[model samples]
Target: MKLYHSTASPYVRKVLMTAWECGLASRIELLPASGTPAAPNRDMAARNPLMKIPTLIRDDGSELYDSIVICEYFDSLAGGTLFPPAGEARWQVLRRHALVDGLLDSALAVRYETVARPEPLRWQEWIDGHSAKIDNALDALEREVDALPAAFQIDQIALVAALGYLDFRFASRPWRPGRPKLERWFARLSERESAKRTVPT
Candidate 1:
């Protein structure tokens, strides 16, 4: 398998981490790909209409896309327990995954608005709205830390990716102040070999 990879993309990191956890990292090859809304990788459109990173091209020449879908594919391929087979646990994991994705979406919105958009056209209100969403998500995670699964599932992998992105791209805005449980959880996960190897540059 080949993955359209971008080290700076937390979504890509999520897929890679999932692959590593599933013990399939050695079987996959990484193909460098980077882009923004202002300049997408046109070639990626052939494999993924949305032109997103973390696109996977299987050995059979078929493709899978976006982080979550690709991660689920990896888990299924490896018969990994990253996803619960069925029950409330599955829904809880999926719900947490959604929260992580929303946090990342808001973070990326803030990043693009501040870094990609011209200063004169930047909207503080839009940035503030997303920032609030990020904070709310962080608070939610902190509140639910005790309920977090002991097994490192898709949601936990995504949380690591999301928090790692905050550290990678928004270091100046520390998120560890009051969210001690979340911070500590991230710290433990960060020490994992998979997390260490996939750290964004």
Candidate 2:
């Protein structure tokens, strides 16, 4: 299997972490794909219609796009380790994943709005909207993060990656305030081998 991945992408890190957690990291090849997102190379487009990073092309010529889907596939291949087996616990996990995913998306949008656009074209309003989502999501997660289990899963993986990305790209925004549990949780997750290996440069 070949994975079209970027070293600095949080979304891509989710899939990589999933593979590592599932003990399938060695089976896939990571390929660096360079191009503006608007005009990604044809090869990437072939694997993923969106021409996005973290696209997984399996040995059988099958492909999976999006980090969530890729993580699910990895967990399936590993006989269900990355996600919960079933029931309300599963829904909570999915909800946590969504929260982290939303935070990442918002952070990415704020980044592109600032760096990719001309100064005059920059939109603080748009940036603020997403930034607000990140803030509120952190607040919500911090409120209940302590209740979650200690073991790793896709939801926890994504939550940690999202918080790590904020520290990566938005250090100006401090989310550790009044959120001791969430901060401690993230601090612990940071010690994981997967996180140490995949930390954004």
Candidate 3:
């Protein structure tokens, strides 16, 4: 298996963390791809039509992309190890994963608005809209932050990654204020093996 991704991409980090948690990291070759969106690397586009980071090409020549799907696939490979087998726990994890995924999406939108688009064309309103979503999601996450388990489940993984990404891209934003529970949770997650290994630098 070959995994093509950038070193500092949070989305890619999600997949890498999944692979590491499942003990599948050794089976895949990690490759770096061109970061240009205008002329994304042909090899990546060949596997993922979207030319997205974190494209997984299996040993059989099959391809997979997108962090959410990739994480679910990894969960399956682990015999449903990362997720609850059934019932309300499954739904809670799914809900938290979905919320944190939204935070990642919003962060990307804000980053692209600033870094990809021309300055004159960049719309503060669009950035503000996405940022509001990220903020609200963080607030909701802080509410039940203590409920997270000590393992590397997808919800906790995605949530910590999402919070870490905010510091990476939006350092000036005040995300830790009024969220002591979430802050403590993130601090603890940072000590985990996967988090320590796959942190975006």
Estimate candidate 1's alpha-carbon lDDT, on a 0 to 1 scale. Answer: 0.94
lDDT of 1 by residue, 13-71 (tens): 99999999999999999999988989889989999988889899999999998789999
Off by over 4 Å in 2: 35-42
TM-scores of the candidates are: 0.98, 0.94, 0.92
lDDT of each: 0.94, 0.85, 0.83
Q: Which stretches of candidate 3 lie over 4 Å from their true place?
A: 36-39
Residue 85 of model 2 has an lDDT of: 73
Best-to-worst ranking by TM-score: 1, 2, 3
Best by lDDT: 1
Lowest-lDDT window of 10 residues in candidate 1?
144-153
**How many steric clashes between backbone atoms does each model show?**
0, 0, 0
lDDT of 3 by residue, 82-200 (tens): 88777988898889899999888888888888888889998889988998998889889988787776556898878767887888878888699899998888897888788888877
